[model samples]
Target: MSVWEFFVWFFWFYIVISCISIFIRVIIDVFRDPELSGWAKALWLLFLVFLPFLGAFIYVIVRGRDMGRRGMTASREAEERIDDDIRSAATSTSAVSDIETAKRLLDSGAVTPAEYDALKAKALRGTA
Candidate 1:
C-alpha cells in the first residue's frame, strides 16, 4: 500500500480503538457506581450491547459530566482514607515509643517520677 493509504488506515484504526476504550471504561464505571440501581445498570448494558456505537455516544453525552465527577470524588476519598490510616499508624507507633523511652529514662534516674507521669500522659494523649 502507498504511504498515504497506510496513514489513512492507521487514523481510522486509532479512532476505532479510542471509541472502544471509552466504551469499556464507561461500562466499568457504570458497574462501579453504587448510586445506579441494578435495573438501570442492566438497561445500560443492554443498550450498549445492542447498539454499541450510538449507545456509547448517547451515554457519554448524557452522563459524561457525572461520570467524571464521580471518578474524581472516588479518587479523593481513597486518598483521604489512605492519609487517615497512615496518620493513625504513625501516632500509635510514636506514642508507644515515647512511653517506652520515658519509662527507660525513669528507670535510669534521668527523670523524676512526676516527669515520667507527665511524659506518659502526653504519650497516651498522642501529643508527645
Candidate 2:
C-alpha cells in the first residue's frame, strides 16, 4: 500500500480509539455516581456495557449528572467543616472526661463510688 494510504488509515484508527476510550470513561463514571439507586444503576450499566455506542450516548445524556466533581467538592468541604467542629467540641468535652472529674465527683456528695467508677470506666473507654 502507498505511504499516504497507511497514514490515512492510521489517522482514522486514532480517532476511533479516542472516541471509544472517552465513551468507556463516561460509562464508568455514570455507574460510579452515587445518585442512582443501586439496582437501577446496575441495570443502566448493563445497558451501557452490552449496547455500546448508542447506549453510552443516551446514558450520558439521560443519566449522567455532569460527573462527580461538584458534588464531591461540596461533600469534602462539609466533611472538613464537621471535622473542625468535632475537634472544637472534643477539646471541651475532654476536660470533663479526665480522672479529675471522676475524683471530684467521688469526693463530693454527688456521685457514689460505684457511679464514679462506672463513669470513669465509660470516660476511659470512650477516650480509647
Candidate 3:
C-alpha cells in the first residue's frame, strides 16, 4: 500500500479498536452496577449484542454522564476499602507492639500487674 493509504488504514483501525474497547468496558460496567436491575442489564446487553456500533454510540451519548459518575464511585469505593485495610493492619501491629511492651515491663518488675492490665486495656481500646 502507498504511505497515504497505510496512514488512512491505521487511523481507521485505531478508531475501531477504541470503539470496541469502550463498548466492552461499558458492558462490564453495566453488569457491575448495583443500581441496574437484572432486566435492565439484560436489555442493554441485548441491544449491544444485536446493534453493536449504533447501540454503543447511543449508550455513550445517552448514559455517558451516569457512566462517568459510576466509574468515579467505584474508584472511590475501592480506594476507601484499601485505605481501611491499611489502617486496620497498622492499628493491629501497633496495638500488638504496645501490648508486648507492657508485658515485658510487667515481667521485668518495672510495672505492677495492675499497671500491665491498664496498659493492655488502653492498647486494645486504642486499636478499636
Best by TM-score: 3
Backbone clash pairs for candidate 2 read none
Clashes (backbone N, CA, C under 3 Å), per candidate, total: 0, 0, 0
| Candidate 2 lDDT over residue span 18-49, tens digit each | 87986777766765676768887778778777
| Candidate 1 positional error at 122, Å | 13
lDDT against the true structure, per candidate, is 0.91, 0.76, 0.90
> Which TM-score value belongs to model 1?
0.68
Models 1 onward score TM values of: 0.68, 0.46, 0.71
- Candidate 1 per-residue lDDT over residues 34-113, each given as its tens digit: 88999999999999999989988888899888889888998999999999999988756677788899999999999999
Displacement of the residue 114 alpha carbon in candidate 1, Å: 12
lDDT of 3 by residue, 1-128 (tens): 89999999999999999988988988987887788899999999999999988888888898888889888998999999999999987756678999999999999999999999999999999879
Model 2 bad stretches (over 4 Å): 68-128
Q: Cα miss at 21, model 2 (Å)?
A: 1.5
Clashing pairs in 1: none
